[model samples]
Target: MTDKIRGSIGPDGPPWPVDLLADLHAGVLEPNRAADVRARVGDDPEARAVLAALDAVRTDLGALRDAPAPPMPDHLAARLDAALAEEARRAFGGAPSRPRPPRPAGRR
Candidate 1:
């Protein structure tokens, strides 16, 4: 996705993670997470549109429930898992190494 279409953070911090969006769309986010998404969407027009689009897609696919979804092949699933792990590692490289504790007045 281009930067414009890519996730954008609202007034808070980083954008809502894709996983949360997926779960929110899937109606499976934990209660607290669901509340957070709702609040964020309420605060951002772009996010509101994204959720609306997801809802539309879900409504359109509602008929497909007649047949159970096909299972993913083990090999394909493993490859996808590995790719996602790699992407996540790249996104959040080795943990923050520096200490972040607030030091007393003038001690550097």
Candidate 2:
């Protein structure tokens, strides 16, 4: 497994971390860094395999969106509800008297 990772390294530096590869595949990487990663992995069979696996996972998760979701078990739902209520009480010092105003949109 480590060897497969090392297989992607170029003369410039160490192997690209799997998380960066995942970000590249997900189109979340900054443009310049994404391009650099692509250039490094373009000819490496191992890196290509990693990218293929990420693609398959993305496809599988997408397919799940169309599938009917299972209902949570009643007991589990009750426990989860209790937990969330407790958290809300702790965080806000009890139930809020009024709903919070919506946050303004856009980056902070």
Candidate 3:
């Protein structure tokens, strides 16, 4: 298991870190590592609590998937478009200062 999975122990509480438990709940860990984490979590009450909270969040988010997303406000959309255009200009050398003459037909 990676260091990220094997979270550090603290004197205060929580044998496993919230992120580690979340990863386990999300099924993002490798099979062997996940099994190890599950075994450890089975014996830890705090870890179980964290997993339960994560499960609730997952259920809520899953429910949202079936619901329609809220529309982006017009003002926010305009701002985002302007930002993206500016970024494109910066990335592609600012859209040629002026339009170039059209190339002759069939020219290489």
lDDT of each: 0.62, 0.70, 0.70
Q: In candidate 3, what residue range of length 10 has the lowest lDDT sum?
A: 99-108
Number of backbone collisions per candidate: 0, 0, 0
Worst 10 residues of 1 by lDDT: 99-108
Model 1: how far is 88 from its true place, Å? 44
lDDT (Cα, tens digit) per residue for candidate 1, span 10-105: 424345544456677777977887877777667656556767888888877886877776666655665666677677667989743432344344
What RMSD value applies to candidate 3? 10.4
Could you say which candidate leads in lDDT?
3
Candidate with the larger TM-score of 1 and 3? 3
lDDT of 2 by residue, 1-108 (tens): 233555554434446557667778989988988888789888767668879999999899999998977666655665666777778888889663443343344312
Cα deviation of 18, candidate 3, in Å: 1.8
**Clashes in model 3: which pairs?**
none
Off by over 4 Å in 1: 1-14, 64-108
**Pairs that collide, model 1:** none
lDDT of 1 at 79: 65
